[model samples]
Target: MKAILAFAPLFARLKGAMLLTLLLSLVTLAAGIGLLGLSGWFLTAAALSTLGSVFNIFAPSAGVRGLSFIRILARYGEKLSGHDMTLRLLSDLRAWLFARLFPLVPLARRFGRGDLVSRLLADVEALDTLFLVALGPISTAVLAGAAMTVVLALLLPGAAVIYAVLFFSAVLLVPVGLVLASRRAGAEVVAAGAALRQAVLDGIDGHQDLVLFGARDAAVASSDTAARRLSAARRRLGRNAALAGAMVQILAGGALVGALLVGFVALEAQQIDGPLLAGLLLAIIASFEASAMLVRSATRLAGAAAAADRLQAIATSAPGIAEPAAALPVPPGGEIRLEAVRFGYDPAHPVIDALSLAIRSGECVAITGPSGAGKSTIAQLLLRLVDPDAGVVRLNGADLRDVAGAELRRRIALMTQDAPVFLDTVRANLRIGRDGADDAALWQVLEAVQLADFVKALPGQLDAIVGEAGRTLSAGQARRICLARTLLSEADVIVFDEPTGGLDFEAESAFLVELPALTRGRTAIVITHAVVPASFDRVLELRAGRIAERAHVPA
Candidate 1:
């Protein structure tokens, strides 16, 4: 409940729309009760008048028609307003979550892709019940119950107390009991659902590997376990709801019987007439309709509460990196220097221990070393994705920590070893580097990467939809597509990690030889185990977390 209440500010934003929805709901309920009560009275009065006194038939008939139309129109308006407010609230939630998600990049390390998707999609959707099923419906039920109690007091005083006790119990106590009993089951449902989603995603992503290893049955068994857990949790929640509904029905019957017993006494003493007594009893029955709605909504309240806790955790958890209170601008030049830097995933075993290096602006440098020798870590340090532990990384003599992350990234772009090509058009993928980049600019980079001919031959040319992760393209073509994207960036410095991956030896050598000319006038750092061409300005090797200068490069 504390977690749910933390979103009060978001709820406050749509207060006006929420109030409108509530008003329409009340109007709809009132019209329904009034229509039922008036019909009962009109029919009874007509039957009684046939024995003696003259009762006008015209007025009651007109009122029944009028109330029916009013009920229809109000019900329509209520549904329209309720759905509109709920959708707007959902939009706000997605926007809010995404805004926080950006600073938490490298989310792959901290969160599983399948789990993150579940939070962003299923958890957010569960919140839709907060307004439509829980708050709005509950509020309408209480208000309608109170109004009906007041009507009974005026017309059938002897039965007023009897109706109030049972009706309020059905609306309030029964639903509260259901929520408390199902809380654990609701959480189980959410956890099981997430596990099921993760299982399915893993199976799909590793289908080929599973087949090769003859482990398909193991994967299927894992998914089936998650499915069975989800089914059991749902069954428990449903059982609780069914019991609560039965309790409400029992109370409704008691309220009707109690009201009838007292009404007969009032009639014998001449305190109420036959027609009015009939109308009051019918109105009491009609009001229980609101109680039924409340019980149904109560079943979902528990799930919504659990979903709120998950969302709140995301909203309040500390970001991977904190921004400075007053960020300084990145300096102009692209001179990068690492001063006695130290860092490691585990502090006891450092990957880069007191390493220092320098590269002047417009210099093209290549650093080559064995795997797991901190080569890729250097790229991450330049991009400020991770900070050094013992020393400072500076840009133009300014500490990287002092500059804003967004500004630092704009100045220094990185093409990681496993850079992905999104499922989008060729033009769209390149535009990620520089939005609004024209056709000429895109074509220029494609030609530089030697992928222009293949792209031009495609049916959609620039508009073609590349399959997921560029599956439709060959391995080398996909690699070059990512290369083209990095080249499109306007940063002063660019770092390429294994840029020649997937290409033939001849193509790799050619690209490496032409790398300096392609990245002219920029500070380029190429991290690779491939042969470094003589065209580069400097070549250094990293070993044991320290730098060693290489005496020669391949001609």
Candidate 2:
């Protein structure tokens, strides 16, 4: 409940629409009940007036017609307002969840790609039931029940008390009990659904690896087990909800019986006429129709609560990088310096210890080291993806922590070996680096990365679709496309983590030869295990998280 309440601000914005929905729902329920009660009373009165020959029929007949008309119109209005409010709420919720989750990409990925997808698409969607099923139905029941109770009290106080007691028991007590009974099963259903989705995704994504490793059977079995668990949990929750609905029906039936028994006594004592007695009995049955919604509402509330808890966990998790309270401006020059930086994935195994280095403005420097020598960590630190544990990283004497991350990233662009290639048009992918970049600017960057010819040969050229992760293109082509994207950025400093990793020796050498011209004005830092090219001004070797050797590369 607390997790769901976290979105109170979002709900507050839709309160007006929600209130209108509730009003229409109430009016719809009231009119429907009035129609039934009036019809029953009018029939009885007409029969009696035919025998007495002195009773008026015009007023009752007009009321029956008017209520029938209102019932249809109010029902239509209720559906319109309710659906409109729900759709708008769902749209806002998706956008809000995406905005909150986007910045926590590193942390989110730790939860597995399939798990994160389930949270984003499935878990977030489950919240729609929160309003449509739980809040709307439950609120309408309470308001309509109160109105019915007040109207009945005017005719017969005893019956009104009995109806109110039975109404609240079915609406509040029965639903509360059902929620408690199904809470654990509801949570299990949510977890099992997420697990099943993750298993399917894993099987699809890693089918090749599973086949190669002879683990395809194991993967299928795992997915089947998850599906079974999900089915079992859902069955249990359904059983509990069915039992609750049965109990609500019994309570509603009891209320109607009590109203009818009381109406008979009032008729015999002349406290109420036959027509009015018939109206009270019929209205009792009609009023309970709205209360019936609570039974279903209670069942769905448990699932919605579980979904809220899951979404809140990710939405509120602490970020890997903290934003500055008062951001400093980015420096004019891209002179990166690290002073005694220390970092580790865990305290027992440090990755970067007392690492100190500097790259002057507009100088191309290359850092070469064996695997796991903290070369890429330096790039991450420069880009402010993760802050150092103990020391300060500064850009032109301004501490990176003091500057806003977006501003810092704007000045320093990173192109990693496994840079993502989104399934979008070539133009769309490149424009990610510089939104609204002209075609000429895009072509220039593609030429610099040596991918212009390949793109031009494609059917759509600049508009060519790069399949998911650039699967449609060859490895070398995809890497170059990513490189072109990085080059399209207006950053003053560019860092490449193994820029030529995917290319053959000839292509690598060619790219290395063009590096100087590509990075002629901007400061460049290339982190790689490959041999350093003469295009760089200096080469530094890292060993055991410290700089072991430094050499000046001659022109």
Best-fitting candidate, scored by TM-score:
1
Model 1 regions more than 4 Å off: 44-57, 214-218, 325-329, 348-355, 366-375, 417-489, 497-515, 527-555
lDDT of 2 by residue, 322-410 (tens): 89999988669889899999988775688989998888999988888889999988988888877888889989899999998788878
Task: Return the lDDT, model 1, position 232.
Answer: 100
**What's each prediction's clash count?**
0, 0
Candidate 2: residue 233 lDDT (0-100): 97
Q: What TM-score against the true fold does each predicted structure earn?
A: 0.85, 0.82
* Residue 119 alpha-carbon offset, candidate 2, angstroms: 2.9
lDDT (CA) for every model shown? 0.87, 0.84
| Prediction 2 TM-score vs. true | 0.82
Q: Judged by lDDT, which candidate is best?
A: 1
* Model 2 pairs whose backbones collide: none
